[model samples]
Target: MDTGASEVAHDFRPFFRVYKDGRVEKYKLIDHVRPVPAGLDPATGIETKDVVVSPETGVSARIFARTAGGGGGGPDRKLPLLVHYHGGGFCAGSPFDSTSNGFLSAMVTQANVVAISIDYRLAPENPLPIAYEDSFAALKWIAGHSDGSGPEPWLNQYADLGRVFIVGESAGANIGQYVAVRAGVAGIRVKGMLVVHPFFGGKETDEMYKFMCPTSSGLDDDPKLNPAVDPDLPKMACEKVLVCVAEKDWLRNRGVKYYEALCGSGWEGKAELVEAKEEAHCFHLFTKSERAEQLIKKMVDFITMD
Candidate 1:
C-alpha cells in the first residue's frame, strides 16, 4: 500500500508547487502581520480603492490616486494615468499587499497621477495568457472612462484619458509589455512604458515561461515572455519607454538587452535605461536605502516630465 501524500512533480517553494496529480498550490512568501485596508496610506497621501474591472471574469484592480486631485484639467497641463502591474513571477503576489501598498503609495504621491494596479488572475488554475488577457481587459475598462461616462467615479472624475502610461515590475513587466504591444490593435493609446527589473531569460529546467505557459516552445522564442525577441518590437505603441534594472539582479542583463533591442528595432520612441548599482530585483519595495529613494526619484521624474 502507498501513503496518501501526493508526489511532487515540480517544486517551486515560496511561490508554488505542481503535484503529480496536476494540482497547484501557492504559498505566500510572508504572512500578513496586520492586514492593510483600502484607504489613505499614512506616509503618502495616495488613496486606494478596489473596483471590479470585469463583471463576467470577476477581474478586479486597486485604483491609486490623490484625494486632492492631480494634474489634468487643461489642454497644456495634464497628469499621466499610470496602469501598474506587480511582480510575482506570474504565480503569486497582490496589488493590495502591504509591500505593494507602500511602493504604490510613494509612487502615486511623487508622480501625482491616477494609477490602476491590476490584480489579474493567477496561474496553475488560470494558467498562462490568462493574466495577460485580464490585464488587457483592465486597460479596456480604463479606456471605457475616456468618454466621461464610465462606471467608476474616480476614473471618470480624475483620470486623463489622453495621457496614459503602463508600468510593471518583473513578471508584471512582461505582462505590461505584452499589453502595450497589443494596445494599438485595441485602439488604446499610451504615452509611456515603465518596465522595472523585468522578467526575461531563463533556462530549460524548471523554466519560468514553460512552467507558466506549457504551450511555449522555449524562453527565447516566446514573444510574451521575452519581448526583446518579438518581431512586433518596433510596433510598440508608446511615445516613451523607461527600462529599469538592478546591477546585482540576475535579470539585469535581460533588461539591458531589451533596451538595446528596442532602440535598435527602429521603434521611433525614446527609450531610457537606468541600472541601480548594488541593488536587487524590486528593491525599492523592500528597503529604504538611498538607492531605493533614488529609483523612486527617477521614476517620478519620468512620469512628470513634459
Candidate 2:
C-alpha cells in the first residue's frame, strides 16, 4: 500500500549524504579554482610553483617563495620554511581554492618564508588516515631535504630547514597536529606549530567525521581530533605552539581548551593563545580587516623571531 511513496527518495544536501544503497553524494558548496602556473604573482610578488610529492598517490603541493625586492624587500638570508595545510572538514577544499591561494601567497610575502601548501586526498573516497598519511609523506619529503640533498632547488637554496614551522587552519590544523606528532616520533625537528581557528569536534561534529571517514575511530574524543584527550601531546615535535581563535567562532572554545591542555600537559614547551576580538572563524582568510593584518604581523613575528 505504501510502496508508491517509498519508491521516491530525496538526495543532495549541503555537505554530503549517504543513501540507502550505500552511495555517498557530495555537494559542491564552494567554487573550486584552478591553480595558477609557477611564476611571479604580480600583486604580491610571491613566486609559486607546484610539485608532486608522491607520484603514486598523486599528492602534490603548491610552493610559495617571495621574489627578490618583494615584501620587506625579501630576506637578506635564507628564510624559514612554513608548510601549510588548507581546511575543509576533510571532505572538501583544496590548496588552490581562491581563499587559500590568496592568503598563502600573501603569507609567503608577509612572513618572508618559503611555504609549501599541501594538497591532500579528501575523504569518503580516500578517507581518514589517507590525508594524514599524505601530509606526513610531504613532511618527510621536506625533511629529507634538510641537508640540501632533496630535489627541490627552491627548498635547498632559500629554505632554512632547521627553522621549519607547520601551520594550518580548521581541519588542516587537525592534520597539522597529527603531522607534528608523527614528526616527533620520526625524530624530525620542527621549530613550531601554529593552529588557526582549528576545527575540532564534539558529538555533532563527530557525526560529520563518521560520514566523511566511515572507518575512523567514530568517537568524539578520538585523540586525533581531540588533542586534549591525547596522552602523547607532550611528545609533539615542536617546542613552541601558537593557538589562535576568534571570539565569534563556534570552535573558539576548542582552541582555547587546546591551549590550556598544552600548557598543563607538562610538555616542557611554550604554548601561547591569541584571541581575535569580535571575529568569526577564519576571518583573516576571507576579509581584509584590521585583525587580518594583525594576524599576518603576528605570523611574521613568529616565523622570524629568534
Candidate 3:
C-alpha cells in the first residue's frame, strides 16, 4: 500500500479567491465548500454544516464543521473532542475543504472522540484579530456552551470534556497557540493544544519582507503584522506551548524562535517541537505523506496522553 505522501504531491492549495485584474479566481478550498451531505459513518462520508458561530463587526461569522461518528455511546462513552483550525495563511481556507479535517476525523474515529473544524473569518477582507477573535470565541463557546445545534448531535450525548484537545495548521496553529496562552491566563481548563506547521509573529523579523515585497499572494503578505493584537500578549502568554514545524519550511526558524521565546518567558508549560523532515509549511494537512501521517499519530498520542 502506498503511504499518503507517496501518492500526494506538494500541497499549496488555498481556500479563498484572489481578486486581481478584475477577475476572481476560486481556490482549492472554495470549491470544496458544502461537501456532499454526510451521515453517521465512514460509509456515509463526512458532513459539512455552515453555521454562524458568532458575530464580529456587527455581522455574523460562520464556521463549517466536518463531523463523523461519536454520537450515542457504546464503549467510547464520554469521548474526547478535537477542535481544528484550517490553514490559509490567515487569509483564506475553510474547514470544509481542508484535508486536515479528514485526517483529524480519522483520528476521532480511532480515539472514539468528536472533532470540530472551525471556519473563522479570513484576512484582507476581515483582517487580524477578526480571525483570531472568531476562533477564540468558538473555542470559548465549546468550553462554556453547547447549543446542540452543531454538526454532531452525538457530541453533546457523549463528549468527554476532560479530554478536550485543540488543533490548528499553518497560520491556524499560531491562532491556536495564542488561544491556548490566553485560555491559560484566564484559567480555562482545556486539555491541550496541537499546533502543526505554525507561523509565529512575522512582524518581529525580516521574514515579512519575503511575504510582502513582491506580494506573490497579497493575502499572505497582508497579515504579516496585524496591529489589532497586543504585541505584549506573547510575553504574557505562551509559556507551555507545543510547536511543530516542517524542516524545509520558510517558517521553521520563526517557529523555533517562538518556542524559545515561550521557554524564556518562564511560563509553566512544556514546549514540544517535532521536526517534519523534507516537508514544507502546512505539510501535515496533505495527510498523504508518510512522515506527515506518522507525525499526526505522534501528535494525537502526545495531546491525548495525561
Candidate 4:
C-alpha cells in the first residue's frame, strides 16, 4: 500500500518551480502593487510617463523626470540620461513594480536626471539573452533620439544625451553591464555605469541560471553571469563604473571580485566599489534606513560629479 507522499515531495518554492519534464511555474509574489500611471507623483514631485521602446518586441520603459520650478516647463538645467534596469534574477521583475517605481521616483529627484526604467523581457519563457537584447535595444532607442529629432518631447527638450549613464540593481545590474559592453563594441558613447548589488552566479546560482537561460553555457564562470571571467572587461564603453555591494549579502564577494577585476583589467577607466555595511542585498529598495539614504546620496553624487 502506497500513500500520497510522492505527490507532496515536489520542489515548489514561492518564486518558481521546476518539474522533471522541464515545465516551469512562476508565482506572482507582489502582484498586489499596481504600476503607477504616467503623471506627477505627488509625494516625490517627479513626473513620469511610459513609452514604447520597441513595439515589435513589446518592450517599453517608464520615463522619470524631475519637475522643476513649481511644475512648469521642466528643470532649469538639462539633466543627464539614466537608463535603469530592475532585477528579479532575470526570471521575474518589472520596472513598474512598487519597489522599482518608488526608487526611480526618488532617484530622479535626488540625482536630478532624466531616467528611463526599462521593461525588458524576463526568462524561463524568453530565456537568457532575450532580456539582454531587449535592454540593448532600449539603449539604441534612446541614442536614436540624441540628435533632438526623436519623437519623445521630454527627452528632446531636457535630456543631456552626451552625459548618459546606465544603471541597474541586482539582475538588472547584470543586464546593464552586458548592455554597456555591447555599447562599447557598437560605438555608443556612455558616460558611466552604476551596478548596485549585481546578481552574480555561484554554485547555487548556477542552477538558477541553467533553468532561466538553458541555452547558455550555464556554468558559474559564464562571462554573462560573471564579469570577472569576461575577456572584454577592458572594453567597457563608459569612462567610469561604480559597483555597490552589501556587507551581509552572500553575493558581496562576487561584486567585489568584479570591481577588483575591472580595476586590474587595464580597462582605461575608473572603477569604484562602495560597501554598505550591515545591510543585505537591495536593502535600499525596501528599508528606509540611514544606510539606505546614504546609498541614495552616493548614487546622486556619482552621477553628478565632474
Candidate 5:
C-alpha cells in the first residue's frame, strides 16, 4: 500500500532523511554562513551619511540617499523611503552588510529612493521587545518630525515621510512584519514591505520534529536565536510584501508560511514569492553568486515597480 507516503527520501546538501525503527528522521543544517563573493560589499559600497531618529531612545542610524540617475537632484526633490533592517539571525549583521537591494544602499539605488537603515539594539543583552520597540519608534519618528539630536544635515537633505517603505531580513524581517501589523493598528499605512527570510511563530508543531533532528537542527534549536512570538498579528496589513525565500534554506518553510498567512489574512498587499532556485538564506551577501544578481534585480523591480 503506497498510503500516499513515499519510501524514498530526499537528500540535498546538508538535509537528509533517515528512516529507522519505524520512525523517519530528517536532518537540516543551520549556523553555517553562506559563501558570498569578496568584491561585492553591500556594507561599505554605498556612500553612507549618519543621522539620528530618536533622542529618547538614543538611536543612531545611517541615511543612504540614492542619487537620481546622472546625480542631479538637490534636497528639494522628494523621494520614497525604505527603512531597511539587515540579517544576522537577529544577533549579527548590519544595514551596511547587505548594501545591495534589501540593505540601505541597495534599496536606495534599486528603489531610487532614500533608504533609512535602522540600527536597533540586539538580543540576549537587549532581548525581545527592545529591538521591536526601537524599530517601531524609528518608523514613527520618520513619519513624524525629526528631533534635534538626530543628524541635521542628512534629515534636512534626504528623507520624505509621505512615501515610506519598511524592509528587513532574517530576524529583522520578524521585526518588519510585526511593525507592519502594528502600523495598521496605529493608522500608519506604509507604502510597502520587503521581507527576506523572516522567522515567524513560536509554537512547535508535530512536523517540526522531523526538521529538528537531534544533531542537525543546528542553531534553530536554540529558542533565543529562532525565538517564537505571539501569533495573533493581523496579516496583509503591509501594503506590499516582497517575500524572498531560498530553496535550500532551512527557513524556507517559515517564510512560505508567513507569506501564505499574509494572503490568507486578506491583506490587499501585493505579494511575489521569489524562489532563489539554487540559493539559500542570506545568499545576497555573497556578491558573486549568479542567483544573487537575480535576487537583487527582482527586489529592485518589486520595490520600484509602479
Candidate 6:
C-alpha cells in the first residue's frame, strides 16, 4: 500500500496514488456524494442524523430510524438494532449518499429497526487493521449506550440493545464478520450477522487487498481477510448467521464456502445461505427490481424474525 519499495509496487489509480517516501493519496467519494436527497423522508417517516463515532479519527455514522408517532416503525416501542457497514472495496464508499440513505430509509419503513450505518476510515491512507479497529471502536461506542444512560437519546429511546444485528454488504460484509468475531472476544452482545456478497480473498492473493494493506500476510494466512482459516469462526458468539451470495459474482464461491465451513465447523448456530440466481455482485443495491426486493425482503425477515 506504500511506496518505500523493495519488491513489487502497487498503483491502483482512480482509487489511490502512491507517491515516494510512502505517501499515499486517495480519491474522494465525490460521485457518490452528489445527487443525494436532502434530509428525512417524511413520506416514509424515516429520519436520519449523523454523529461523530470517533472525533479524533473523523469516523462518523448516519443513524436511521422512524420518527416518533410515525407509522413506519411498526408497533413495537423498542426495535431491533441494525449496525450496518457499507461496501466500497475498502477504499471508497459511504452511507451519506442518496442510495445508501434511501436504502436505510426503506429498511426503516419495512423492517422497523433502528440502523446505524458506520463510516469507518478507508484504506491506503489509513490501511486495513485501522479500518477494522475504527469499526470495532464504533461498535464499542454503540455498546456504551446499552445501559440507556450513555449519549444519543435516539438509541436510548428506540434501540433494543439485546437484539442486535450486524449487517454488511461486500467489503462491509467482511468488516461485519470481523466485528462479530471480535465481539465474541470482547463479550459484546450480538444476535446475528447478515453478510451480502462478503468481500473475502481467494486462494491467490487479492491485489486490491494487497494494495490496501501492504503489510498483510496474503489472503491465505490473514484471518482478517480469510475467515475459512480463522480459528474463531466456530466461536463467533452470535446465535445465527446469514450469508448471501450472487450467482454471477466472482466471490460467490468464497461466500458459499464460508457457509459450508461455518456449518461444518461445529459453530453451534443456525447458518443460512442465499443465492441470487443470475445476479452479479451487489446487484440488490442498484437495480430496483423484484429480485432486489426479494433479497431485501429476505434480509428483513431475518432481522425481524425471532
| lDDT, each prediction | 0.82, 0.81, 0.58, 0.83, 0.61, 0.82
Give the clashing pairs for model 6. Answer: none
TM-score of candidate 4 versus the correct structure, residues matched by position: 0.91
User: Candidate 6 regions off by >4 Å?
Assistant: 1-9, 17-38, 70-76
Question: How many residue pairs clash in each candidate at the backbone level?
Answer: 0, 0, 5, 0, 6, 0
lDDT of 4 by residue, 113-138 (tens): 88889999987778878999999999
Write one digit per residue (lDDT tens) for candidate 5, span 10-70.
Answer: 3322334433322443343344434332233344354555566677777767666544342
Sort by lDDT, top down from the best: 4, 6, 1, 2, 5, 3
Task: List runs of model 5 lying over 4 Å from the truth.
Answer: 1-46, 66-76, 96-103, 146-153, 202-232, 235-237
Candidate 6 yields a Cα-based lDDT of: 0.82
> Which candidate has the highest lDDT of all?
4
Name every residue pair that clashes in candidate 4: none
The worst-scoring run of ten residues by lDDT in candidate 5 lies at 206-215
Error of 5 at 296 (Å): 0.7
Tell me the RMSD of model 6 versus the true structure. Answer: 3.6
Report lDDT (Cα) of residue 229, candidate 2.
Answer: 82
* CA lDDT for candidate 3: 0.58
lDDT at position 249, candidate 5: 82
**The CA-based lDDT of model 4 is what?**
0.83
Error of 4 at 208 (Å): 1.4
Output the better candidate (4/5) by lDDT. 4
Which of the two, 2 or 6, has more TM-score? 6
Q: Give lDDT for model 2.
A: 0.81
* Steric clash pairs (candidate 3): 4-288, 4-289, 5-288, 5-289, 240-269
Error of 3 at 126 (Å): 1.4
